[model samples]
Structures are given as structure tokens and as C-alpha cells.
Target: MNDARDVTILGEPERSDRPARPGREGKGEIHLVHMYPREMSIYGDLGNTRCLAARIRRHGYAPVVHQHHPGDELPEQVHLLVGGGGQDSGQVTVEEDLARVGDRLRSLADDGVAMLMICGMYQLLGQTFTTVGGRQLPGLGLFDVTTLGGEERMIGPIVLSTDFGDVVGYENHSGATTRGAGQAPFGTVRHGRGNDGSDGTEGAITGHAIGSYLHGPILPANPAVADALIGWAAEASTGREFEPEPLDDEVARQARTRQIARLLG
Candidate 1:
């Protein structure tokens, strides 16, 4: 990530013009649990996990990714867990069996492992996400979101801004996430609300978990998003004030602008 090296007047001072790297080599390992990545890995949701693991590896950190298929035991020491999007029909097929893992998942959630769930996974985190087919499948309810499915699926680019920065990704989902009496929306919609039909309350976040309907497989261009998740894992591991190197760069900035334009169009 270094562009160049320069000499300073004060007896050769060192400046970190290169990108910040987390100490991941043999330092410790952060584990990622992939849930039904095959059955429901729709749109770019799978990219979320990939970007997450990559970002961690880019930094000085070591990441261990574990795929959780049917009949596999979930790790008790997972630093992060990622669940990707899927189609509603696909969701229905696995909803019951997946729900069986709810109690164990809730236990993991309670353990303070950071999680990122997109699209169908986002809908499944709620109490129930009703599909256009008039089916209301139960969710893990790890978050306080509820979805009402519709025909007009939200599929396209989108723009979102958070403490991290302006992020560009795609929106593709049929269910609308409605925060209940005391629930908070994940982030304000700058443009292209994720749930196309409704007023675009894509998903919710409870504690260290984030569920969003936006995904262009949403990453690569936005390293800050990846760093944000990595930061969460770092916070859990180091047990101290966690700070990461700035994620903004010229290449990243231009890419972000182009992505937002596609969303605006």
C-alpha cells in the first residue's frame, strides 16, 4: 500500500505513508462461519464474507473461515459469523431446518460475535419475513426486524453513508424490514432504498451485528466496510481501545464515486 518513501531532516524519521496493516500473522486467528452459503448465496451476498476474510488477511491479522453445512457443529469461539442472501423460495425450503439452528445461533449472538447478514439472511434475522407468495417463515429474531414480502424486488445499485463513510453497493430484495416499536433502522437511505417497493428500511443492527439489504456483492471498492467488521473482531480480541489505519485512499475514492453514479442512475 506504500506509494513512496521520503527522508526527513530529524535523523531519518519514519512516516507510514503506506496503508495501515493489522497485526494478523500468528498474532491470533479470527474465525468466520459461513451459513448455507450454497443454498442462499444470492446476488453478491457471498462477497460479503469473502471481502471480510480478505480485509482481515490484508491487515496483519489471520482469519479462519469455517463453512457450516447441515449437521456440522458451530464453533464456540467464532469471532465473526456471516450469513448471505438467497431467494424467497430458497429461503422457504430451508427456513424450517435453519430455524432449528436458531437457539444455537442466538447463543453465538449472545456471546458478542460480530455478524453481517445480507438480503434473505437479513430477513431471516427478524421475527418473520413474509414473502410475496403469502408465506410467513419464522426467523431467528436475533434482531427486531419484520418483513412483508412483495413482487417488486429491489434490484440495483444503492448509496449509503455511515460513520465509516459513503458506501456504494447494490439493493436486491423483496422483503421490507419494518422496525418495531423500539427498533432502529440500520442506516439512513441516501438513495435507492433497498426494499424496492416499501420506503426502503433495508435491515437492522443489534449490538455488534449488522443486517442490510444492500449488496452488489458490496465490497472490494469499499474497504472501509471491510475494515469496520475487522475492527469489531479486533475490539473483541485485543480487549482494548481498537483503532485501524484510515481506509480512504485515492483509488478507493474514485471507485466509490463511480459506484454511487451507477446507483444514482
Candidate 2:
């Protein structure tokens, strides 16, 4: 119920003293908004925001992170949006508040603002989510998909063949989502369950908005996908192409490789 703005420059605790890296002097700020952080950040999903903020800084841009809660106004300018998963009770808690700002979120997506919605947030961005008890929750309809809660919870490591490359993460959900004909999947599932246990599709994507169930916080090991989101946001904010400096991702690469191998083998 506390709607105060919690702003932070992720990674730089002492903003006044740290000297800017060479070539990073002129780059401005990229506003990253985290929606319902208090209610929807279960399963370490807050890591996604931290990952983006750190990477944004490493890419020579300052990440201005805004944590949005119920009754709070969204920042006037949002370069990127990140929302995480939560329990059914948590979903119910934010259901009304989510609807209140659904229009703004949909508008942002239509205008190509980059967004990443994970698990419960992903489900709520679709047309509808029917819980196991037959209760229905209305979504923002950003993704042309529908979800039905099932008895079986899909939980495990997952690998997806995506446009960005191989994306690895963990999926834990009971919602079985089915995409409409107009919806394009974020990736093809290569291992474990995705939106549904049977669909072979991992997630849904339209324009710059993406909805996925993969959570191992989903960004640390899949830097490619994270960078893609950052790139889209940067371009949309600046109205120009974004060329980020290459950061060493060897550790992430190795981590991804090991996860994939462990899952596939």
C-alpha cells in the first residue's frame, strides 16, 4: 500500500566519487522500471532487475531503476519494464492494481518499449488466466495467449532456441498457456516444460515485449537475451541505434553451456 518511489542507481552506491569509464562520459540514463517488485519478485526474480542494471552500467549507460508498487504512478519515461513471478495469493493481491495501469503498459508495448514479464507476470499479460478452482483473472492482453492452471506444476531447467541464441533458465509454473495464431513464440523449447508441458514453445513475444516462464532469474546466464532487451530499450529511448561495448561474458557462457549440457545429457 506504500506507493512512494524507491529510486536507485543500481551498482553504484557512491555515485559522486566513482570516475566514469573512458567513452562512457556522454551516455545518458536509461530508465528501468520494475513493476510490483514487492508482490511479484518471488523465486529470486528480482535478480533480473539487478542483472539489467549492472549490464546497463557496464555498457556505459546509467541505469535509473524505479520500483513501482500498487497505487504508485509509473515513471514518465520508462526505457524498459521488468516484472517477475509470484504465488497465486500474490497474484490476487496485485490483480486490481495491475488492471489500473494495464492501459499504460499496453501502450508502452505497442510503442516498442522493451519489457520482460516472467512467469505470473507473463500469464497476467495475456488475455486471461483461469486458476485451478475455475476463477478467472483478466489480463492486459498484450500477448495473444490464454492460460489455464493445472494440477501438475512444471518445474525444471529449460533450454530454448531463440533468435538471440540458446537461452537457458529454470521454469516453475502450473499455468498451461496456449498461444493464439497471431502470437509468435519467444523461443522453441529444447528441454523441459515451457508455457505448457506439451507445446514445444517456450514463451510469447510481440514487438519489444516478451513473456516467459524461465526464471533462474533468467538473465545472469543468458546475457544474450538480456543484452537484446537492453539494446531495444536503448534504441527506443535515444531514437537511434544502440551499439553497446562488448563485455566479457565468458563466465556466463560457460555457465549456460554447463546447464544446457546437464539438461540435455
Candidate 3:
């Protein structure tokens, strides 16, 4: 679907209704699984999936978008996974289901599946998330990090220096996440509060799996990051080098440039 509002809490899986635009065909199918779209996608995060699907089409791949919710079985062949942020109550609601599939998720990470977990999902993919009320939520331990809810909310546009160049997004979270020693970070904070207010690190990266707090819906403005994930998924799925055909990203570039200027200057 083009809009996140189109996502509904249904018993079965829902595929994207967006028709495939004309592009080179026969590249292959990329299975994208979106986790907890209804309960955990409050922050316009579903846009990430839409962006990926659109980009996949541009690169000559047919995107098979799958919406995975609580109590639902995961797609057997997942090439890429994307999840969004949610509130504490929403986290609590999906905690059990996440735990049930935690092993599978972890295994996917270990198997080099390309995945992105943002905000609340990012926290839950870590070692633990202790709420301000002292309720500790167990995580999948995919990232060697721990999160604790805090009183102050860190909300702003954030810029990060990464291998993908300067990635830009918005951060709206109060969870202070501390990465374990020796754990690699996704990027370094250039403008906003990162994992914790004090840490220079932004997000955690393990293999091809990434967990971050940035949510400008993230992907639309950062084509490099999106392409990186797509490349990884494509390579892992086909066991071949995946070089994506370039597309016109002038609008995204202009948006990113302006946002960076406004936030940095």
C-alpha cells in the first residue's frame, strides 16, 4: 500500500496493492517482511517498506511485500525485514509475539539476512529493555546492547556519518541504549542524540542486521542506506553480486541537503 493508514490488523497476510511500474523484468523476486505493521508502526515507519518496494522495482526486481503481525507465522523465505517504532504499550503488546519468534529472527540475522529495526523494535532487538516502571522486556540479543526507559524524550532531526555517507533521519525516543564493548555501531552521531544522549554512537549493526532509532521513516531520504540493504538481501538470496541500476533521486537529495543545512547550520 502507498499509505501506512492502509495497513490493517487482519488474520492473514496482506500484500502491497501497488502495481509494479515498468522496469527490466526477470531479475528475481525479493521477499520483504514487515514486522508488526499494525501495532508497531505508529511513526509513519511503514513508508520504509513502500520505499523499498518502489526501489526494488526500479532495480528490476519484483518486490513481494509481506505484512507480519502478532500471532502470525513469518514468511518462510524472507530476504529482507523491516520494522518500525511504537509506544511502550505497543511494545508490551508485541513483546510476547516477538519473543516467540525471537530465535527465528536471531537465526535470520546470523544467516546474513538484511534487516532494519527502528526505535522500539530496535530496543527490543537488543539484550533487554527496562521500562521506567522497572518492567524489563526481554530482547532477542541480536545486538549487544541494552536499553532503559528514561524521563526525557530525545526528539529531533539527526545526522549520522556512516559508510553509506551521511545518513539523515529523525529520532524520537527516550530509551537510553548502551552498546556493549566491542560491538560495532551503525554510525556516529554528527548532530543529534544517538543510542544514549552521551554516546557518540547512533545504532548497532550485527552482520547485515541494523537496529537504530532514526525515523524520518528513514529510508526515503537515505537512498544509500536503502540500497545497501537491498544489495545485501539481493546478494544473499542469489549468491551473486547484485548491482542495482541507478534511479533519479534528485528530490530525495534536495530534501536531505535542506534538512542537513537546517539542522547543522
RMSD of each: 8.6, 4.8, 3.6
Ranking by lDDT: 3, 2, 1
lDDT of 2 by residue, 80-153 (tens): 99999998888888999999998999899989999999999999999999888888999999999999998999
**lDDT per residue, candidate 1, 1-265, as tens digits?**
4432222211234333343343334445667787877767867576677666656655555666777765567876687888778877778877876777889888877877788888888888888888887878888888887888876666666787765678777777667667876766666677876543456544677778888876767666677767777887866776754455434457867988987776665
Off by over 4 Å in 2: 1-25
Error of 1 at 31 (Å): 0.5
* Candidate 3 lDDT, 83-122, residue by residue in tens: 9999999999999999999889988998999999999999
Model 1 scores worst on lDDT over the 10 consecutive residues at 3-12
The clash numbers for all candidates, in the given order, read 5, 0, 0
List the global CA lDDT of all models.
0.70, 0.87, 0.87
Model 1: residues with Cα > 4 Å off, grouped in runs? 1-24, 196-200, 238-249, 261-265
TM-score of each: 0.83, 0.92, 0.92
